[model samples]
Target: MRYDLDTRNRALTLLRDGVSNAEVSRRLGIPSGTVAWWLHRDRARNGGLPGAHRSTCHTCHGDPLDRTAYGYLLGLYLGDGHIFQSGKHRVPNLTIACCEDWPGLIDAAEDAVRRVFPHNSPCRVRRVGCTYVKVYSKHLDCHFPQHGPGKKHTRHIQLAPWQREIVDEHPWELIRGLVHSDGCRITNWTTRRGKRYEYPRYFFTNVSDDIRRIYTDALDRVGIAWKETRRGSTPYNISVARRESVQVMDVHVGPKF
Candidate 1:
């Protein structure tokens, strides 16, 4: 693997240095065909060129630009070596109309993705639809483990093929957590003039080991007493001691801080 990597890099440098592929291959004692393959694969892996190959040369006939045709091209790209074998994908259900408008949709999605995941590397559009599109990125799938060992965890849906593929490819990215929100009632609600009475209540919609750790750390930091409660038809709630509210700034750090 190291020898191959070194040879491939040397071939790329030669190509970039204006040395002919055939000449490079001959000088390196490697086949010209092999050199060409290496050069193409290297460029594609680095996102310098499209990841897949064309079936036939386009000089003889105009290439098909139709969405249906591009779907196959997109699939080829997705399955190519450019995508890290460790990372998996989320299968998107695309409509014909969306696929037909893929180019424009891709342009829009690129802009949106940059704003949210600015550090994220560029992703090639692997597929598209009226309402959905699949993009190749460093994202991986996360799964919630089953309640107990020896039992399949069907409570949460399993990751789809694309997602599983990515997850398997990049196991380090999997993160588990629970999402929570709070609702409150005013203290003056019971008084005749307390029209806006507030009761502080927060609930957890999902629970995982990670969630328990986070809440535990938070409560410990504030020196506040906390209790978990469950009631009829609602959800799991956490009641926090109201003796004193912790300063928000002390709880969160800003870049400048």
Candidate 2:
């Protein structure tokens, strides 16, 4: 029953903000006893209530942004993430839906969010077939400007200069995140002249033209070649089937679990 640092910090913050223990528990979906225990422990350590006195603590704030972290988050956001504001709250919620089939990607997404916002606690909720990483933070909007009213392709999607710099510096990492969330690496077998041969390739499918373009642009920065194709009339596909390109992608992205 050991909660992580982010969870403990979030519970404390909610209590400090005058939220009842039950409310905090409900919001975070943790046991009420755990919330009460954490608050009691904090009060015992401090001479007064948990939030009664403020002190200088660096750990009480968010972590500084890094290229790899930002790039990964951006790629995930572009792929399976969405930003929405609840009817009752003004602050926006950033939710990334990860398939339960790939627990590693879900863990990676959770870890990336924790690294970027060390002080804020991201909650994980289980659905029928997928898990969602949800965070309520205004700072999320600053990082992902792609948030809008309509779908990604219907709206404008552009990268800020700083974001561009990060993508330029760490294209491989960005590509890894993008492919991990929306693309897959698989072995394709074909029979030619009664002989069967297998080759490894990568494919990324998305409905957002802009997002696909950003993905391809990142690949281009890394000198990896990709081709664009369409499945029917809606979803666009980007395939990297060349031996050299596949090798490059394998080195960076590997296989998602």
Candidate 3:
């Protein structure tokens, strides 16, 4: 095809953006066969298409703080690496230990914020040796009681409002059957016998009886065997004592009966 350099590059940009050759050909009034040839030639010369060659994974030698990649990463995390199914593991809240294990997790998180709001950038990413408990108080937990010593971690993903709305609207249509789970610590300090006291906490989820009943009914209809269970009014309930407390943390609902 004969065209100006700018026009040709524009077409190439479309291809880089994931438009297939057939679609590009139709849009640009070029033959599909010619588009295919150009794609092959571009790949041969530049190693790969623009975004294709650029590692989608932040861990793959790209800047962990790359906003665009991190925004996508946050979505993946919020979806618990997948959507609408049982998660392989529980979600965990932000912590020094978790960050250490993932290496550049903070960078990716910060990048996500920047990518979402390019004009208003804030440096929320930091390398802290201490965790929330250490910096704040031992009794501080985020939302639920599933936190603290001897408790399993709950993974929490920061979802944008729109993303949360989408998930909320299609509670059953989560594509991969899982969403990221995490933990948060909400500190409730106390004073005992004129001395300060701290307590570790944890959380668990209590779905509604209505939802459970519906689930069990669906299972029964599908000939699946499942034990019936009771439900509670609140999704998250907390049981507190002198030394410790526990709260509802995570809940998974799907139609895989």
Q: What are the Cα lDDT values of the candidates?
A: 0.37, 0.84, 0.38
When sorted by lDDT, best at the front, the candidate numbers are 2, 3, 1
- Global Cα lDDT for candidate 3: 0.38
TM-score of each: 0.36, 0.75, 0.23
Pairs of residues at least 3 apart in sequence or in different chains that clash in candidate 2? none
What is candidate 3's lDDT per residue for 1-257, written digit by digit as tens?
47787767878899989998888988989888877877788897875655434322223333333333333433333322212112552323222222334334444444543453333333332446511111111111321122334322233223345443444444432321221123223445689899997754322122333323322333334333433322453433222222211221112221111
Greater TM-score among 1 and 2 belongs to 2
Clashes of 2: 0
Write model 2 residue lDDT over 1-257, tens digit each, in one string.
78899999999999989999999999999999999999998887774764454321223343357568768988888888899898998877788889999999999999888776665678999999999998777666666767888777778789988789889888877898889888999999999999999999899988888889999999888888888988776558999999998987888898889
| Evaluation by lDDT, superior candidate among 2 and 3 | 2
| Candidate 3: residue 55 Cα off by (Å) | 6.2
